[model samples]
Target: MGTTYLTARLNGGEARYKLPGGHPLTGRSTPDLELTDDGRLADHLHGGRALLLDLTDDPELRALAAGYADRVDTLTADCPSRPELAAVLVRPDGFTAWAADVGAQALTSTAGLAEAPEKWFGVPAGAVTPG
Candidate 1:
């Protein structure tokens, strides 16, 4: 009840949190897996910005995240262990700051996809995106 996993505004107010299910990786440590793009995901997480460890083919989410490329390192990789996770936003300290799940029924979002970097890292320079 105390730790709200979300930072983004929902309906102009904080999102009502529910435990149990969102994405398996939400609020947990990043899994030790080798991604296709990078040999290891943990390798890229040491940088200043959070890494968007995307595991699905969600172009809209990736495109939306792309706008703030200057604020994050988007890694599109396959998670063989938990393929259900659509994406996970990994903080620099190697924790899952947010996540989005794969399909309906269990379809989910932690609301940090677009807001986490601004919450953890400072605002982007003039809302600038990657060129």
Candidate 2:
């Protein structure tokens, strides 16, 4: 397969890519695979939509995930080594779009959660299709 790394800036930091499924915040994990309507997850998103892994149950954090659900499959689960993150955005190709740290400020800001969709999904909110 061709290289999956696509770089774009997020959260005021220059974009960085670790191989998909190779890092705590980058890879698809067991929970990611186990989560589905029938308890089966695809290795890659069949459609182009991004996926948001909401590892936290905090109402505020869940709301944060929901705000982005228009462009993502927001799933709540226990992730490995992600205690510091409120959530992680996984692209359709199973790569991380962005990661949110565990802070009320960070979780609540549009800056932390919004930038990745534009950078990764190439579509604005309420759009019916993604590029």
Candidate 3:
């Protein structure tokens, strides 16, 4: 699944939450991504382990970025101005589980952490303990 789709799914679920936005944009197109930052949508991928991909200069990655940008609203948050600087959280099955602009928080709450591990890391519900 794509970042937009995954974000929508997460928002629909009980675990939906937002973080205060003040994250700095990084990667090859930092300047472009920063232009779209409005600080409304809180970055959910804050502190948890994440998979970061640098697609700034890759054509294939750029194509994937376009697909994600077009469906930004569908994912439940403002899309980064440049999708190439975006980072997507992936489930063990290789499905996109969440999308966050670069430098944004990945996980900030127990619910967010639980959802990520269960949905993305393939960890069972019982296996995760809230902090």
What lDDT score goes with residue 92 in model 3?
A: 24
Query: For candidate 3, what is the lDDT?
Result: 0.34
| Model 1 residue-pair collision total | 0
Residue ranges of candidate 3 with Cα displaced over 4 Å: 1-84, 102-114, 122-131
lDDT of 2 by residue, 11-128 (tens): 3223446442223555332234443333434543566777766666656655545655667776676544446666667777555656666664555455345556656656554548
Off by over 4 Å in 1: 1-21, 104-112, 122-131
lDDT, candidate 1, 12-56, per-residue tens: 233233323355566666666666656787777767677887787
Question: Per-residue lDDT of 49-80 in model 3, one digit per residue for the tens?
Answer: 33323323234333332323322211222345
Q: Rate the local accuracy (lDDT) of all candidates.
A: 0.65, 0.55, 0.34
Best by lDDT: 1
Which regions of candidate 2 deviate over 4 angstroms? Answer: 1-48, 61-70, 122-131
For candidate 2, the 10 contiguous residues with the lowest summed lDDT are 1-10
Model 2 TM-score (2 dp): 0.50
